[model samples]
Target: MTDISPILEFLPCPTPEAWIEEARKPENLAVILVDHANNELKAAQSAMAIMSRYRTGKFGQNRGTSHSNEEKVGLQLKTDDQLSLLNKMSRLAREELRHYEQVLAIMARRDIPYVHLGAGRYAGQLSTAIRTFEPFRLVDTLIMGAFIEARSCERFAALSPWLDDELKKFYLSLLKSESRHFQDYLTLAEAINGASVADRVAIFAGIEQDAIESRDHHFCFHSGVPA
Candidate 1:
């Protein structure tokens, strides 16, 4: 098992026990898997978005459209740092998609049909802390990624004991990658800023802690205490 102590210490607080109880309920199992799949897709999209904006300097302007690799964009990577961002985000996105596929496979086998689930305020709340500028905006996004991945790792560890053997094994298997992803995002954030992001990280931690400990009607993978 991956060592989650560092990740736990990094966060402002732990996931509420009430939320864990909600998650472990048999009725909520479908909701948990579905939301987890959606979250994985969103994670991939987030990484791709970062690469498009920072590496290619163009995104969202050509939605649902495809362009050749050589096509010109607002900006292109001209530095090693920029290329590094591209490389890391590319790998992260691929991994997230793979996770999504794995979750879908599990859902299929379990006969849990994929269904619509609403978004939780956890991410939206954290995203509000992101600045509206360039370099700082990217850094803040990366830090948020770190927080999300770390929380995922923490929750996997917390929930594994309550799950059936199959899911328990699966979630446990994901810890190392999730932990690495958490560290990668933090490393990228600091690299982008050319300085330690401890201050920026602290700001998001407050928001994350509130999101977790607050009363929430939803039972999302990242939702707060059950209302």
Candidate 2:
């Protein structure tokens, strides 16, 4: 068997005890499963946005490059900063697309059908948040990515223990990549800004906490408190 054990030490995880207890309850299994499906959807949507805005031309279709993996070709980068931002965002988008593909494969194995639901609230909010700053755009976007990935890592760690062997293995398998993705975003944010991102971190931390804690009609990976 491939060793896919999580690098638990590296994750900023929450206490798993509560999550395990809650997840094992029969009523919560469906919730957890649905949430996982929603997570895949959100990730793919985020990746699409990154490709549409950061990679290709913001206005017209750039042509030729179509798939999620084509980062270097067909995209006309405007500036060095844009190029750098595109590279980082493209990397993230690719990873997210892979995550979506992986989860869909899992769903297929389990015979689960994922319906095409519209975008969730947190994603909409984050989309608006990304448009406000010019120079800070890339850093802000990266920080947002970090926050989302970190929280996903935290949640996976939290919920893993309650899952069955196969699910537990899958959830735990997600930690390393998710944690590394978070770190990558943070690193890019800091590197681009050339200063401590403490204040910005704190700001987005609050926003993310609110995004996670607020009640939402739809439940996704980043959905707020249960409605």
Maximum-TM-score candidate: 1
In angstroms, give how far residue 7 of model 1 lies from its true place: 0.5
Error of 2 at 181 (Å): 0.6
Tell me the TM-score of model 2: 0.69
- Displacement of residue 148 (Cα, Å) in model 1 is 0.7
lDDT of 1 by residue, 132-219 (tens): 5455667799999999999999999999999999999999999999999999999888876777999999999999999999999887
> In model 1, how large is the Cα lDDT of residue 85?
85
Give the per-residue lDDT digits (tens) of candidate 2, residues 98-134: 7767777776786666655555676556545663433
Question: What lDDT does each candidate get?
Answer: 0.87, 0.62
Candidate 1 has its poorest 10 consecutive residues by lDDT at 69-78
- Clashing pairs for model 2 are none
Model 2 C-alpha lDDT versus the unseen true structure: 0.62
Give RMSD to native, each candidate.
Answer: 6.3, 8.1
Off by over 4 Å in 1: 57-78
TM-score for each prediction? Answer: 0.90, 0.69
